[model samples]
Target chain A: MESKPPDIQLRRLDDYRWEVPQTGKMRTRGLIYATWDMLPDIRTDQSIQQVANVATLPGIEGASLAMPDIHWGYGFPIGGVAAFNLTEGVISPGGVGYDINCGVRLLRSNLLRQEAEPILEDLVDALFRNIPSGLGSRRKDLKLTTPALRQVLRLGAAWAVKNGFGTADDLLHIEAGGQIPGADADLVSDKALDRGRDQLGTLGSGNHFVEVGYVQEIFDEAIARAFGLFPQQITVIIHTGSRGLGHQVCDDYIKIMMKAAAKYNIELPDRQLCCAPITSPEGEQYLAAMAAAANFAFTNRQLITHWVRESFEQVWPAGPRALGLELVYDVAHNIAKIETHTINQVTKKVCVHRKGATRAFAPHHPEVPEAYREVGQPVLIPGDMGRYSYVLVGTPQAMVETFGSTCHGAGRLLSRHQALKAAKGRSILQELAAKGIVVRGASRGTIAEEIPEAYKDVDNVVEVVQGAGISRKVAKLHPLGVIKG
Target chain B: MVNNSDPPKSKSGYRQLAHTADLGFRLYGESLADIFVNAAHALYGVMTDRRRIRGLECREVVVEAPDSGALLVEWLNQLLYLFDTTGFLGREVEVQEITSQRLQARLRGEPLDEERHQLNTGIKAATYHNLEVKETAAGWQATIILDI
Candidate 1:
């Protein structure tokens, strides 16, 4: 870990925003969106220093930005966002993290909380059984050949739909229509292909989960109505990402980028931040491979969504359509996209990197699906299983300031080891049970490592983004049951 | 023949470190080859109980890199790929040759049996964040972070 600078300087812009002045080799400043309550904890870590480090990258168009859920990660701090000029900027895999399109997908149902409460245990068990999860999780039934897997890499969620995992309409609600353009299966390595072959429809371990929840509170009735959400209505949230396939894609490219960085003579503050010019061959190949891995993630989630619906059907003895289990929206949290943003009143194309952040494009933005054009894109922020998760809408302010990005989730406050130590004697499952939450996990240690106390209060994190006017609250979902990998 | 059940009796081993969002392991060894072997052990230890894995199979892996850091990442990623694709676990790793630029190793283990092994965590890949292999008073030390 990088030693914390003794005197990390900061200028408070507001109660919800702080700035680290440009100094040394920094091309721009560092901006952190957080409240005073979150600053003390955020400052204790090295993430703020990462923000400063990012500001020094070549061709960084704006300040290195971090959402309220900032935490220390490998190169770019988790929740970090930075935009690079298309012509002059560089593309770093570290900025996108290991999980290429690690994201969240929310599903709304017509069933009421009261109606599902009695069968919550059975439902959770069915989900746990139906969804292959935990370490080394693979589906025995859905193994894909190299040829079929290539289609998955190229088509993403659309591939899953075509394979009878979901409806064609489901693709419309997904980011990038479930398949990012420019993905080339040829760019992916055989190692990645082998790793991803049997892993589709499986929920890999560590913080990835499927939670059964209900809309417990509504902040904006009109927007909530537009989002197809109502009080006490059941919902499901799937949190996962590209599995080993994406990891290998990133691992494969990081080596290539390291050489490319040296070849291009781009000075890197950290080796993990290795990058190449946007138009370089190395950069283009990495983007294509990353998109293919991202498509794998999209297809993985779509397959899981199908199984989730099946689990519900088995328990309730009713079809998914009868249960109204329709997809709300799917958004990628860890990704880099080519977008046009106005900088100093000049609209320019830039590669926006959102690591541990979500794109919150404003209403009427061409990227916003026509179905949600009036109320804006739905931003899903999943908190720890024990606390409430939130649904927020994108805002014009986000487009203006953040290059259309916002916080992803409640950031971690404790290390896994620390959480393990704190949970030594307590039965985390029992504790959750007392709160009327049904919880099932592949391992007890995983449950302990993910205790609610290990994460910052997501409510505070959400408040900062809303207070900053980058996102507006819509409804809050309370968990009833959860299945963790 | 190497007895896979017996753990490497090396003064230099590995220990888990603290990271807010991912897993970090600090490895130490008396020599560069020892460090490479121990790093493999550390990785397998993180995924499952290494003792239960038998040395019924052996596979040779050779990787060449421009530097030691990238070399280490490539080595670990090779092991990860084996596990991910074929459920091959390394009970023991014997470094036949080691240098800053290249390494040749014989990995001995068997396919993972769900009923026989208790799997712990799935590591995505080894990262280069603050990655360095250096000589210490104790010999050699390296710190690697794994994205989980």
Candidate 2:
């Protein structure tokens, strides 16, 4: 493990919480949820310092929080969460990340693992062929015209359903019904539009993938049943985001925010944390453009879902309806949302920034779909491709302490260079095959970089959240077949 | 003076740096203009094998920023925009003129032919995380982290 930075001091508040006291320009304290055993690894990076940095932001409420999967990110730590008072708070592009609304969607199928195991390779091949994956991959058959692309930006996943991509039922399980409000396509740049034109259905590289797996174990049978998951039942998970369009939007806004920060005299410890007040013209414009990019991401996943169903149809000759392939839930991990959270015994609207974090609204929250309102929002946590991913539910504790947020995934423990070195002279493919898992990838480097051991164990990450009472585990899914971009 | 006619085939100007969740590199050049050129080379180096690219196409690029840090990011992002939208990969970059406020360059490369070239990684964007551009005893040095 790398040595911890000496300046960061932590006091254990409880079994699963560590306190970074407010000091030196901080407006609030910093809270981190992690087991003691994970501290040595957590302290290995500058993420702890970033938590403190976030506390220093203006109008920050309660505390700056980091989840167990926390790692050093550009401005905010990955798995970081913060809430700011609407009047005095600031909205930053860094907090939402480059891949705006980068998220995951789960599709539960009626088929059993035994049924998919026989044709797993062919099934994965079909999915890989149907869904474009990798760097610079674009569909030759479905490039959107400029006007249609603008409609996609405006309508989000609704555009996909209207264009015959997926059913309206798919949107019901999505966060914000697969469309964030306040999106203005005109606020989005022409460059961003061009980048997203032909890239809608493509899964651009790096940690984005489509995986076929099965429910290996269930932690909460009632919640698992509520989520339409059963033991040994096959499932599909699509993990991606707004692609190049989002990247361009973020790049374009950082430049604008840089000047806006200076214009507004908002002090920034890091340039990446540059922002404008929530009510500022710059902030409103950014929010609008960001929502548009988020909508693009929702539509991207919707189109991919359409193809995933078609891939199954080609493989089994049974339709998606017969296979019972229905969307369980879709949640965005990287985003900022305007939420009403009670602070200091008063309810107020605050802009909540969840960077590399998932919103886990407590049971019966209105945002939770009607079907899942009793169990809370379904949170999908994807592990590294070779190991097991998890299904989790939001808890009241999370809503109270974390602005209804939880860890997104098994955060990176090793860099790409380290993973590549470790993978040397070893065939990662054959190794995974030996474990009875089938895999295909667009880039060899992406595969090596995503070696299972390169990340912290999802089991450990979920355990911390569960132990902390922030999120409750529902089920664990073991990978059977995978396609990585 | 470095030869403008020759491409940056040598790895001396830039070296990979370890970053936990992204790709990073340290660049060295004799002047700010040289570092800008090397930064573009390093950016493409992370995306694909630069050796396979040839100077078969040329494009003119211009960008402006309020300071050197933002300028560096803008310069790199412009090259990335071209690559993402037009499939134009840069093998050589020549900064014709540069200041803290503006930069103009001539890019030489060919459009990406996936069948002929080996793509290694996909970079999302260049970040301002601990970004630096300075003149040291060794001349000019820059540190950049690219989100992948």
What C-alpha RMSD does candidate 1 show over the true interface residues after superposing them?
7.6
Model 1 Cα lDDT, one tens digit per residue, A125-238 = 999999988878889998999999999999999999998998988898988898998999999999899999999998988889999999999999999999899999999999
lDDT of 1 at A152: 95
- What tens-digit string does per-residue lDDT give for candidate 1 at B21-120? 8887777888998878988998988777899999999989998888887789889999888888888999988999999999999999998787887767
Worst-scoring 10-residue span by lDDT in model 2 chain B: B1-10
TM-score of chain B of 2: 0.90
Local distance difference test, per candidate?
Answer: 0.90, 0.90
lDDT of 2 by residue, A1-485 (tens): 12336758899999999999988998999999999999988877788888998888888888999999999886889999999898889999989999999999999999999999999999999999999888787787898998999899899999999999989999999999999998999999999999998999999999999999999999999999999999999999999999999999999999899899999999888888989999999999999999999999999999999999999999998876788889999999999989999887899999999999999999989999999989999999999988999999999999889999999999998989999998988899999999988889887888999999999899999999999999999999999999998
In terms of DockQ, the best-performing candidate is 2
Which stretches of candidate 1 lie above 4 Å from their native place?
B1-11
Write down the TM-score for model 1: 0.96
- lDDT per residue for candidate 2 within B1-148, as digits (tens), equals 1112322433248877777788887788888998898899998887789999999999999999877877888888888888889888899888899998899999999988888778678889988876788877657877788999
